[model samples]
Target: MFADRAHAAPARQDPSLGSTDDPERGDVPGWVLITLMTAGLVVLIWALAGPALTNLFEQAIARVSGL
Candidate 1:
């Protein structure tokens, strides 16, 4: 009795589909923002650790030179 109702319905068009007009497609903006944020984080880390790194290098140099 269920054999007559087993036919598939026609495919419907989607209204929310994206257009293909833009040349710079994909996640370019997201990648650029991520790179900028990573660079900012690196700069911040260097700023916070610069003095300690300098001190450590100075101590290493002094120890090596026997001064």
Candidate 2:
């Protein structure tokens, strides 16, 4: 009984026989580009504002300690 049903089932096409476009292509490169861009922006912002931020923090600390 089971054998008849199994033979009646349609054959599935092999994945290698399908479209040339890959489902997972470029996934890593896209993430790497995004991560690199974010890192570069963070570095640029830090470089531009690092001294000012440090001075502000030091002033705030001095005021608190003086009080």
Candidate 3:
């Protein structure tokens, strides 16, 4: 009875679940955008903090040399 019912049901193909011909074509631009944004953020942070870091390093050197 189970085998008869299984054979009577038709196979359905879902259009939304179909495979794409160019899967990797969309990813390259997104990765490039992410990399550029990350680099820009790093440059901005370094630009903002560079002066204070330099002063701190100079102060540490002065204290160490005096000892």
Candidate 4:
């Protein structure tokens, strides 16, 4: 109920994060690391595969254009 919620004390934030910051916000660093690692993997894979993929595409286009 609205009345019960209004009467209850507010939840406490984590002490190390400063008083205004929520404890649950800690997961952002982990998510950022995961996103950075995924991006690095994508770049590495593209670097390794880009020339082969381009060659394959050119061959396919050449066959079609010849037809």
Estimated TM-score for each candidate = 0.60, 0.61, 0.57, 0.60
lDDT of 1: 0.86
Kindly report which residue pairs in candidate 4 clash with one another.
Answer: none
Which residue pairs overlap in candidate 1's backbone?
none
Give the distance in Å from residue 47's predicted Cα in candidate 1 to where it truly belongs.
0.5
lDDT of 1 by residue, 10-67 (tens): 4565657755555666787899999999999999999999999999999999999999
* List of clashing residue pairs for candidate 3: none
* Alpha-carbon deviation at 35 in model 1, angstroms: 0.5
Across 1-67, the per-residue lDDT of candidate 4 in tens digits comes to: 7899998998887777675455755677889999999999999999999999999999999999994
lDDT of every predicted structure (CA atoms)? 0.86, 0.88, 0.85, 0.87
Per-residue accuracy of model 2 over 1-67 as CA lDDT, tens digit each: 9989887967776987764467856577889999999999999999999999999999999999995
The residue-level lDDT of candidate 1 at 16 comes to 75
Error of 1 at 10 (Å): 19
